[model samples]
Target: MTFTLVVPDLRFSRQAGFNPLTEMALPGLASLLGRADRNQLGGQSAEQWLRGHFKAESAGAAALSRLVDLPAAAAGHWLRADPVHLRADRDRALLFDAGLFDISAAEAEQLLSALNSLYAADGFEFVMATPQRWYVRLPQAPDFHTTPLSVVTGQDIHPHLPGGPTALQWHRFLNEVQMLLYGHAVNDAREQAGKPPVNSVWLWGEGPEPTGLAKPCRSVRADDAQVQGLALAAGLPFRALPPAFDASGADGELVLLDTLGRSARQGDLYAWRAELERLEAAWFQPLLAAWRAGSLPRVQMILPGDEATLAASLGPAERWKIWRRPARLEECLVMGS
Candidate 1:
C-alpha cells in the first residue's frame, strides 16, 4: 500500500516578520523530506496536479465541484462564477476570495437571484450548492480559458481576466453585474455593517466536463472540491480528510491538504501558521511514524506551489541511503528572501 499527500501552500517567501514555521517542531516533515527521492511537480497548483492525475485534459473544475453536492447536475458545460470582492488600489484593483466577508446563504441567494433574474434572457443561470461555491450554467462555454481565483487573489485582477475576442464583451457584462450587486440590499447591509460587499462573480473553470477518468488511487481523502469531484467522477470511494491517518493501514490513499493554501490565498499569515501546526501534529507526524515503522510500503508527497511544485517519495529501503539525508523544512521549500 502507498500513501500520497498533496499539500499545497506550504511554500513561503523568506520575508521579514514572525516566521510561523521557524520555531515549529516538524520532525516528521523533515524526516520524510530528507529520505525521499525528490523531483519537481509539473503543475502550478494542486488542481492542476490532480487534473493530470485523472487525465482530465478538458474537464472544467467548476463542473466537477458542482457534482459533489448535486451528482445529477451533470450533462452540461459548467463554469465557476464564484463571488469575489475587487479591492481598488491606487492604480489597480486587487481581487479577494469570498471567505473575507463570510457571506450567508441568504445573501448569496439574494445576489444569485438578482443576477439570474437579470441575465435569464441571455441564457445565463446562477446556481449554488454551497454559499461559497457557485456555478453558472451557460448556454455555451466561452472561447478562452481563465486563471484560477487562487492564482490572482490579493493581486491585480485585470491582467488575469480572460483575454481574446470575448475579453471586451465579458468586461462589459461584468460591469453590468457589478451595477446590480452595488444596489442590492445585501451589499447595502454589508457596507452598513462594515464588511466588504459581494462585488463580482469570477467566471472560470471552463472546459469540457470530466470524462475518460480512471481511479488514480484506491481511495480519496481530500478537503478540496476538485479532488473530491474527480474521485466521484471516477467512481472511487471519497471522504473528507480525517484528523489523522487511519492507524489500521493505508490503501493507496491520496490526501489533499488545502487549509494552508486557502490561508495563503487569503493573505492570512497567522492562519497559515496555525494550519501548518495542526497538520504537523495530525498528518505529517503520523505519516512519518507509520512510514518509518514499515507499516506502510511507500510514501509520496507532492507540494504544489507557484513555479516548481516539490515532489518526494520514500520507502523502507530509502533509510539505508544515508547520503540523501533529511533536509531542513526551509531548505526543501522554494523561498524568497
Candidate 2:
C-alpha cells in the first residue's frame, strides 16, 4: 500500500445538502477559535490518541482525523448563539477511506477484520477493498463545533485552507448551482403559462484541477515507480498535477468534481440535520408559500432514486431528474413571481 484516500460518502453528503467545498472549511475553525493548533487537529488534548490508533496509515488519514474538536463552550453555548451548523449528518461515526494495498484479498480481508474487531470495541467499522484500498467508518460520535457565520459582520468563521484563503468562492459556486436547479424547474412552470424561459448565470471552470493527490508521499511503502507503472497499466488517471495552488484562478469558472476523498473519522450529525433545517427555513418555506398561493409558476423538475424523498424533507417543489452527470446549469427563468 502506497497511496491512501479517506473519503466521505458523497451520496450521503449530497442527500444532506453538503458540498465538499463547504465540508473542507470546518476543521480550520478549531484553530481560529483557539481550540486547536496544527498538532492538535486530531484530539482535544492528546494528539497521540489520534495518530497511533486513529488509523494514520493512509495518505490523508492523519489529516482527516484532526478535522474537528471540542468547542470552547462545554454546553453548546457557541452553537446556540451561532446556530449555523451544516445541513447534513453532523455526527461522523464512520470514517471511510480507500487504502492501496498489494496483499492478497484474503490477507486484506483478514487485516480488515482484525482492524474492525480492534476498533469495534470503540464502535468503529472498517471496510477494505482490493488493490490495497481500505475504509474505516467510526461509529461513535465525537464532540465538535461547526463553522459559524459572523452575524454582525456577515463574515465566515472557518479556517481557510493553508494560505488563509477561505473557499467561500466554492460555496457561492455551489449556491449558484442550487439556484440554477431551482430556476430550471421554475422555467418549466412558466412554459405551461405561455411564458418566456428563465435566465441563468453561465459558469465556467477555473482554478486548479481537483486531484486527490495531497503530496508525493509513499504508497504503503511500495515502490513508487512500480506503483506508477501499475497505475498506468490499470489505466488509472493517477498523475499528480503540477501545483496549481490557486483555487481562485483567473478562469473564474467553478469546477465541480467528486469530493468524497477528504472526510474525517470523526462524526458530526448535528451539522447535517441543521443544514436541512436551515434550507427548510430559508429556501423551501418561501417556495412552498408561493406554490400555495398559486403565484408560483408550475416548476419542472427531475427526480432521482431518492431526490423526491429527500426534497420532501427539504421543502415542497416540483422536481424531476433527467440524468446525473456533469450536472450542468442551464439557465434561470424568473417568472411573474
> TM-score winner among the candidates?
1
TM-scores for the candidates: 0.93, 0.17
Clash counts per candidate, in order, are 1, 48
**Evaluated with lDDT, which candidate comes out highest?**
1
Residue range 142-212, candidate 2, lDDT tens digits: 22322211111112222311121434543453354334433454445545666433221111111221124
Q: RMSD, each candidate, Å?
A: 2.1, 26.9
lDDT of each: 0.81, 0.26
Query: What is the TM-score of candidate 2?
Result: 0.17
Error of 2 at 237 (Å): 34
